[model samples]
Target: MDFDEAGKSLSLEKDEYIELVEFFFPAAEIDINKLMTANEKGDTELASDAAHSLKGAAGNLGFMELSDLARSIEERARNAQVTGLSLKIKELKDKIAIIEEAFEKHKNS
Candidate 1:
């Protein structure tokens, strides 16, 4: 992710950018976790809700990859398509790892 670009587009200072990212980190993590659990249980509504939340949060933070994956999962879950839900969930989880790594690097820096 382009941290500098995102911060500039959002009109945030460095510290403010980090703070905003920090605030969103856990929410996105939790929602992704919930999405997986909901998928496992065939809970379409729950999964869709979690995916929707993750999609918005990821997009807001300029995590475009995550945002796009979350959107795919959201639409699939809403449509009750469980055929490839696990794979989609796995992809979303992988994208979450990217943000987690970025957040860790930001914290360490």
Candidate 2:
């Protein structure tokens, strides 16, 4: 994905961008875990909070699709809509996997 080039084009310092990506990598995992726990415990508020947090972090890293998906999850959680959350979570995980792969490749490059 050429995150370095993307950062340059966006006027973000390379080191700053790398740090942001690193920060998000672990944060996303933690947030996803928390969201799953919240869902299992039927704690909609916590799930919403987790999803909201993920959305902000993803958006900051220019992960527009992830951010959008997170936003939808957050909204659904807030509304007590759990019917499709599982599917959404799976989709989000897949997206994160792709992003992680790109991050790893870019970092090594």
Candidate 3:
């Protein structure tokens, strides 16, 4: 989805919107990686923290799917129900692809 509407809703000019998209992508990518590593290491607290941070940022940027999925993973980690954490991570990866696509789209616009 083009983020023009999301930007408009937030009262962002195109340039500002593009910058925000650019900024979020890199940080979100790092958070995803952190989630993966922490989950692998069985560090639930770390995983929860990473997911929670990413979720809020993603939601702010109108990436609801990513934000909601991250919230699920975060809650699961916090509740000590990380049985399918890998699947959750994979879902995040897929959501990140959509975010990447949005980034490229907005980058060119």
**Which candidate leads the pack in TM-score?**
3
Please give the RMSD to the true structure for each candidate, in Å. Answer: 1.4, 1.3, 1.2
CA-lDDT, candidates in order? 0.86, 0.90, 0.89
> Ranking under lDDT, best-scoring first?
2, 3, 1
Shift of residue 55 alpha carbon in model 2, Å:
0.3
Best by lDDT: 2
Candidate 3 deviant stretches above 4 angstroms: none
lDDT of 2 by residue, 1-109 (tens): 6688767876899999898888888899999999999888889999999999999988877888999999999999999999989889889989999999989888888
Residue 90 error, candidate 3, Å: 1.0
Clashes of each: 0, 0, 0
For residues 12-84, write the lDDT of model 3, one tens digit per residue: 9978987888899889889989999998999999999999999999999888888999999999999988899
Clashing pairs in 3: none
Model 1 alpha-carbon drift over 4 Å, by segment: 106-109
Query: After best superposition, candidate 2 residue 67: deviation in angstroms?
Result: 0.2
Question: Candidate 2 at 9: error in angstroms?
Answer: 4.8
